[model samples]
Each structure stands twice: as C-alpha cells, then as structure tokens.
Target chain A: MQPTGSVRPGGRTARTKAAVTEALVAELLEVGYAGTTIERIAQRAGVAKTTVYRRWGSLAQLVVDAFADTAGAQVPLPDTGSLEGDLRELGRASIAMLRMPHLRAVFDVVVREAIHDPAARSALTEFFAARIANGAAIVERAVARGEAAEGTDPAEVIRMVGAPYYARAYITGEPLDPALADRTAAVIALAAREGLLLR
Target chain B: MQPTGSVRPGGRTARTKAAVTEALVAELLEVGYAGTTIERIAQRAGVAKTTVYRRWGSLAQLVVDAFADTAGAQVPLPDTGSLEGDLRELGRASIAMLRMPHLRAVFDVVVREAIHDPAARSALTEFFAARIANGAAIVERAVARGEAAEGTDPAEVIRMVGAPYYARAYITGEPLDPALADRTAAVIALAAREGLLLR
Candidate 1:
C-alpha cells in the first residue's frame, strides 16, 4: 500500500521521492542490481518514468541515494553515560540493522558495487565517513569523561569496535550473535584503555 | 601461449586444469562473473568444451577451484618463535595478497558471489575455514610456548588480527597501509595477552 494524500513538510515532492526510493529498494531485493532499472522502479512506485529520470538521473545515483536513505535512518548515537554502554548500543544497533533482510540486500549490493564501481565506492565512502564521524563523537565524550585514553582516535576506535563483527559476518561467514556485540565492545574498550587506538 | 609439450608430474590433465583455471581468472577480471562462461573459458584455455565440462563439471565449481588454487599458493605460516612475529608475518602476507590486481579481482568476485549464491557461499566458507585453521595452529604454537594465554581461542585470535585491516579495506574503503598491518598485529597480540580471546 502506498501513502497518498499526505501533508508533509516538503509535500508531494518528498512523498514522491520516498515512494520511488522505497520502490527502488524492493526492486533491488527482488531482481538484484543487474536487473534493476529506472523503468521497473518507476512502475513499482506508480510514478511517471520521466519523474524518476528527472529526479535521480542515473541508476547508480538512484542506488546510492537509496543506500544513503537507509543508512540515514539508523538509530542515533546513544548517550548511556559510559564508553562501554555507548559502544554496546552501537554494536547492537549495527547488528539489528544488518539483520533486516531488505537492508542487508541493499548493503550487499552496495558493498559489491563499492568494490567494482568508482561512483558506488565514493558513495559508500561518504556514507561510512558520516557514520564514523558520529561514532567519533561518542568516543570523544568518553575521553572527556576520563573513561578512555586522551589520545585515542575516535574514528579508529569505532572501526575497531566494528571490524571483528563485520569480519565474522561478511568475510568468514561466522554466525553473528549478541555475544559478539558484547565482545566487540569489550575488546575496543580494552584496546582504547591500553592506548592501542591512538593516532 | 598453450603449453603442449610439457611433461610434468600430473602431466596433461593437471596442466589442462591449471590452464582452464587461469583462463577463468582472466575472464573474470576482464568481464566479471556474469559475463564469464564455460564456452569462453574453454576457448581461452585452448581446451575443448567437453574437456572443460568433464573435468570441472560446472562454472561454480570451476570458480571455486580457481579460488582454492590461488589460496593454496599463499605463503606458509612463519614460525618466528613469538606470537607477535607470526601474526605480523600473517598480516603482511595478507595485505600483500590483497594488493595484487588479479587476486583482488578474483577475491572481489568470490565475495560478491558468496553473498548471493549458495554454492559460492559454501566454497568461501570452506576456504576461510581452512585459512582460519592454519592461523589457529600458529596461535596454538604460541599457547604451547606460553606467549599467549593458555585458554585463548586460536580462531578468535586470528580473526581479531584480520578484522581491522579487512574492515578498513572492504567496509570503510580505507587505504590498506603497512601501518595498519602492524597495528592490527599489535592489537591482537595485546588482546591475546589480556586473555580477551579466551573461548
């Protein structure tokens, strides 16, 4: 079911963009990147082909926008008063986001494209850079509170927190459990305290 | 050029298999997975279609075999007497392997296929399992020599050693530098000493 007659901030234009992005994601999961086309997405979204073309311009741009939209929807950073709590929340949120089938499908395509296509690679780089910046803020708060070392690089710390879980899930094909999130948080916290994440 | 007159240990069959596998890698790099076909591979390998079919049986199997062949040719684990030294060697070797254009192309295809295809997933799982097992042996040697904690999970330790570098390479699209390898080895060694890698 599509949302119609919605009175929002950006009105019909925002609704139309949302509809098309949603349709793009569905098309991606259904037929994969190679089979996904602007025509099919426009048809699925019940929007005019020209509208889809005028808005996104290219399939690569559309795909990148869809990925960015999904990533932007992730839960905001938690302020649980401690570095450990913040990292645990981040890890849990990451695992939860990755568990969604639609999101995982979109991410799989993005990662594959990022490896091969320059546009996709740059899009993914920008997306993660934003996420990493958010993660850095959490580590900065921890440092100010004296929970972590002074010189610990926030971005590097965030990367360490994520690396093991991602390596297991994407690379080694290991089963991702809640315990992994906890262990990842603990390992990063320990490494941070030991000044291993210093720039 | 095709080698016709070579008489080696496994002779023509082995040589033909190697040639076909090599051709498959080249085709994968040139046209990617979707464009690679048995017909083209057979042609490029200078072998008949029937020969290719009868030997590898399927394109999936052929791709898996090619990955296996390349992985098996990696440098053997170093016995540097210390866990840190062995891990550094492993990290350096992994970065070097991932830097090669041909190997990176093959790995990219395998990783993408593994995400979408059941057969490729299984092949990749098995391949990584073998690699992790080798890394475990190195850790086990360290444990025996008291370089690491007694109860460390060797596989987990190895995963820690690889996670940061791979997360940067594949996830965040960060540059894979020598410093990353050294830092990864140091962090894992620290984590191992702290008994964080215990099962």
Candidate 2:
C-alpha cells in the first residue's frame, strides 16, 4: 500500500519522477492529450496511482512538468566568434530539434493543449521566453564585438532566425529541409547588417 | 409520412448544406474538435441526423469540407507594379485574416486535428498548397514587370513574406500588429531583390 520500500530518500524520488515523466510523454504520444489519463500514466510508469496523484495532482500538471523536464534542458549558446555563425548554429539546432519525431509529437500536443488551457499556455509562453532570453545573448555579443548594429533588438534577431523555419514546419506544414535553416540565418543576418533589426 | 412541400430541387439541397456547414463550424468553435458531434451539429442545423450522416459521413470529412468552404474564398493577388507594394499588400491581408476570431478558432481546431488525423493533414496540406499557388502570381507579375530576378521562386517568396507573421502569431504567441506585417513584407522584398530567393 505504501509503494513498497519507496521510502528511500532523494535518489529514489528523482528516479520515480523521471519514470513518471517518461511514461507521461509516451502516453501523450500514444493517446494524445485528450485521451491521456493519469490512471494510464501511472500503470505505464509502474508507479502507484496514489504516488502520481500526490505528486502531480492532475494530468495537466504532469504534462507541463514532463514538457519542462524534456524541453527545459539547457541548449548551449553558440559562441562562434561572429554573429552570422552563431545565428546559423542556433537556427540549425532549433530546426533539428523540431524535426525530431518525438519532439514534434510533443510540440503538436502541447501547442494544441495550450489553445484552450490557460495553465498550459502560460507554461509554453514561459518556456519560449526563456529560450528567447538565452538566444538574445548572441545578439548582445554581436553588438559588443561591433559585428551588429549598436541598437539591434536582440530578441527580434533571435526570432527572425527561427521564424521562417517554424512557420514552414508548424503553420503551413511544409517540408523543413536543411536548406531552410541556412536561408533563415542568411536573411536575418542580412537584415541585421542593414540595420533593419535595430530598435 | 413524407414532409409537406419539402421537395424543392437544388435550392433546398444547397440551403441544407449551408446550414449544416454553419452548424459544424459553430460546434467546432464551441466544444473543440474532440467534443463536436454530428448529432449536435444536426440538431443545431435543424436537419435530421440521417441527412447529416448521408452528406458528410464522418466528422473528419465534415471538418475538412467546412474548412475548405471557409478558406477557399478568393484572395485577390496584388498587382501594384512593384514587388514591394504587392508583397506588402499580401502580407497585410494574411495577418488580418489570421487575426480574425472566427477564422482563428477554425484554424486552431483544424491544425490540431491535422496532427493526429491523416485526413485532416492532407486536407490542410492541399488547402495551403492552393493558397501558395494563388499567391505565387504576385511574384510572377513582378518578374514580368522587371521588379524581381527572373529565377526568383514565386512560392518561396510568398512563403517568406508570410513566414515571420505566422511565426509570431502562432509559434511564439507574439502579438501580431500591422507593423509586423510591414516588416515582413520589407524583409522578403529585400531578400528577393538581392536574388537570395532565386532557385
């Protein structure tokens, strides 16, 4: 009844959390957000229903936590010594991550859920805001190095680099080939050089 | 048991279809894709359940048809003699359309449905492809007017013009203002003028 020797300290708790998060993602992919259930996730995770219930409280919370666990991993900012090179690297990484089948499936569900669920929407907004802040550093470095305009909007530069690829991938459902990353980086770099991105 | 004077020819059939489509869209916006039911749609439309079933057969079909009906309206291609003017018009139109509450709700449902349903995905793909094709004429006319390079990819140019706005509107959940549309048009026109969009 007590989850059998689950009284172990931090190590076991971390392991249980990881297992539950993994199961939640797998269940989400298999059954979609509408069909995913806390009971099913508990069974799949090999954890007690009460444990899951006590920890997450609801399926929505579990999903947001799972998404944060997976997507919240630190993406190393490129320090390639040039604004163009750094943006190219960032764009490549962003597109490649979105292209992954598992990540794509997760994004589809999370974005749809965010449409109607305020909590999910807030979580997603926070996730993207964090990413944008992280990427803004690249533009800041460029400005310091005299590689970009002094007044360039760092967040706008970052958004420009990833915008085209995300549009193709999510909005229009177009094929996202490697060339798109290159083009996106090139266009943003061109715009920044022309002082178009300056605030 | 036949209904009195209910046998008008094509006019009645057209009216019935119009009513059913309206009901389907309203239901989708009200309860979302998973919750929308043919029975409810029929009830709201004042049509018999058998009529709904006989016409649409399934929710997926009904949704796709409804989407096509709504989005299939002609979006007149811009021909302002200059690529910049034309692209600006197109971009503004696209942003305005997406900002509409009704169309936004329909897009939210269709895009989410497309993720898990093959029928919905194909329908969306086809719809977008047609739109891209229609918008491509702007580039063609620009080329004829000597405003763009001969090798400019029409579809690519159109995509570029719309990509940033779509990205802001949907992916990053950023605010879509008129200024964003102007900037999108300017960037794409600049890139195309530089022959970067040439195949």
Candidate 3:
C-alpha cells in the first residue's frame, strides 16, 4: 500500500531516522555536543549502534543530520504589502522563535558547536547566509514599490532588523518584550527608507 | 611601604588573584566550564590548593572572581562631545573588542555560563544593566542639547547602537568591517535625532 502524504511514518528507515533525531535532541540537552556519542544516541534511540555508525560515519555527520532534521531552522518570509509590516512581523517571529525552548536549543547547539569547531562554525555561518539570501525577497519587493532605496542590500536590512533581539538575548541575557520587536522594526524601516542600508 | 599611584600589583593578594584568574582563563579555553575543576585551576596557577579552597568556596565564586579580574568588563566611556560621536566610538569599540581574543573570551565565558546557570544569568543581566545606565549619560547629553527627544531612554540609544555589532558577531560569525561601524553610528544617530529611540 502507498503511504499517503504526511499520513504515516513510511517505513523502517524513516522510523529509525525519526527515533535517532529525537534521541539526538534529548541527548544534546542532557550531555551537550561535546559529550554526545554514537553509542549513547543509538542506545537511547533503541537502534543498532552498527547501523548508526555505518549511516553517519562520524559524530560530526550525525550531529549535522540531527540539526537538519530539526524543525527550528526554517523561518517563513512575510509579505504584508509593505516592508515595514513585513519587517515587524518577521521581527516579532524572530523574538518568539528565540523564546521557544526547543528552537532555542537547536540554535544553542549550533552556537556551542561553532565555538570550538571550524567546520561547525562554517556550517552555522552558511545556514544563516542562506536564510539571509532567502529573506532578501522582502526587500526586493520593497525596492520594486519604491519603499526602499534602489541601491539597498536586502540582507543588510534583514540583519539590521534582527540584530537587537539577538544581541540582547545572548549578550545581556535580558527579557525581550514585545515592544522591542516593534521598535526594532520601526528603526530598521526608517533606516531602509532613508537609504541608510546601502550595499 | 605606602602604596603609590600606579605603583604595581598592589600586594600579594592581588598577585595571587591575577595568577589564578589567568590560569582560569587558560583552563576555560582548554577544558571549558563543564570540565573546569578547582584542583586543576590551582595546580595550573601554582597556587596552594588549600588557599583556593578557603578563599573561593565554590567553582561559581572562582569563575566570578576571574571575570571580575578580567579587563574586558571595563569599557571606557567616550565623551566625543556629541551623542553621534560617542555612539560611533562605542560601536567600533564593541566590534573591536569582539575580535580581540582575550576580550572575546571574557564575554564568551559569561554567555556560556549564563546558558546553564541561573546565578550567572542574573549577574550577566545586572552587569549589562549597569553598563547601560552609565551609557545613558551620552543620550542625556544629546537630549539636553536638543539633539534628541526629551522622552528618549538613554540606555535604549546605547543598546540600539551596540546591537548590530554584537548580533552579527555571534550570530553570523562574520568579519566585521570598519565601514559597518560608521553606518551603524549614522543610522543610530538619525534615529536618535528623529526621536525614534523613545522611552
């Protein structure tokens, strides 16, 4: 029988993958990236250690696969008719996402891994670069409507809008109120419209 | 002998603190917080283990003391005669500080500790709060000179100016260019002048 879309776990391979990723996240929160081992992860997932070793080949590959399987990295682009509105929505979503524990854990893993490993650092950098590239569509639309400067770099605008929340969260460990989201959006919008975020 | 201004390490206690702190930083980079032990720190510092045990009861206190002894916490306030100038100087300093290995280590310890420890989180929050309060002086000067809105929160201006650099450094792990400092200052200055950084 054909497995309908989103209706089933599909097969043994899919089930093993899901179990392994779930165990990976749980193990990450418990022992962190440095302490994670294929043996423990396999045992936690009730999968054969040989299968895990053969599939991943290395701890790095396993960790990367786990992150790829996590749902947190995917962020939606907003189209609210105006760049300001889109920015505001995106800013609010960014804050909300950071506050969510599971999502935050994913980022924490990436950040923690990047701290000591060069390859992890590059992976983290590339992941955000891709997201930033995708987010540029919002600014391109704004440019089309003459809401932003023609010479503006779209990624810069996204980075500017998202900076405050990320900075305050990691640097100060402060509580991020909803009001901050709005203020950041307004500030970024003003800067974008004023031709400040140029390439 | 009476202590003279800028004479030396002050006394024996200061010397011990300095040595222990330095050892702590080295151990941190090597073993990280989870792996840090008082025995290893004392042995590395060439200090008596008994002295370390008696002086700082717990690992937390020792870590805090190390941060206190760290020079990175002391950020000089720039009195550039205008809010714009002061903010620009401060922003550039923030970027440069992150790039510097020793200074970045100080912040990374704080951030990493705060991730798993509640007390460290409070201290991190309060330390930045105090810095923000002191930074408010810049905004106050601007407000008095009618360069900014009267209702503008001074700390908000500082945070706004500092946000981009901190966010990009940690999140993107990108190389911060000097040009970003100028642009950040200009955008923040425009916002402040336009009364965007409200209370």
Q: Name the best candidate (by lDDT).
A: 1
Q: For residues B35-86, what per-residue lDDT tens digits would candidate 1 score against the true structure?
A: 8899999999999998888767788778776887776764588888888888
- Between the candidate structures 2 and 3, which one is better when assessed by TM-score? 2
Docking class of 1: medium
Candidate 1, residues A97-133, lDDT tens digits: the string is 6788788877877777677677788878888888888
Tell me the deviation in Å of residue A124 in model 1.
Answer: 1.2
Off by over 4 Å in 3: A1-11, A26-44, A49-64, A71-74, B1-11, B26-44, B49-63, B71-74
**Local distance difference test scores for all models:** 0.81, 0.79, 0.78
Proportion of true inter-chain contacts also present in candidate 1: 0.59
Model 1, residue A132: C-alpha shift (Å): 1.1
Q: Which number leads on DockQ?
A: 1
Interface RMSD of 1: 1.6
Better of 2 and 3 by lDDT: 2
Which DockQ value does candidate 2 get? 0.49
Error of 2 at B22 (Å): 1.8
Q: What are the per-model DockQ values?
A: 0.55, 0.49, 0.45
Candidate 3's residue-wise lDDT over B1-199, tens digit each?
4223224566777777788888877887788766888899899989899878777776777776566445335677899888778888988887887788765765676666666567667766777777788788888888998888879878888888878887777777777886788899888888888888888
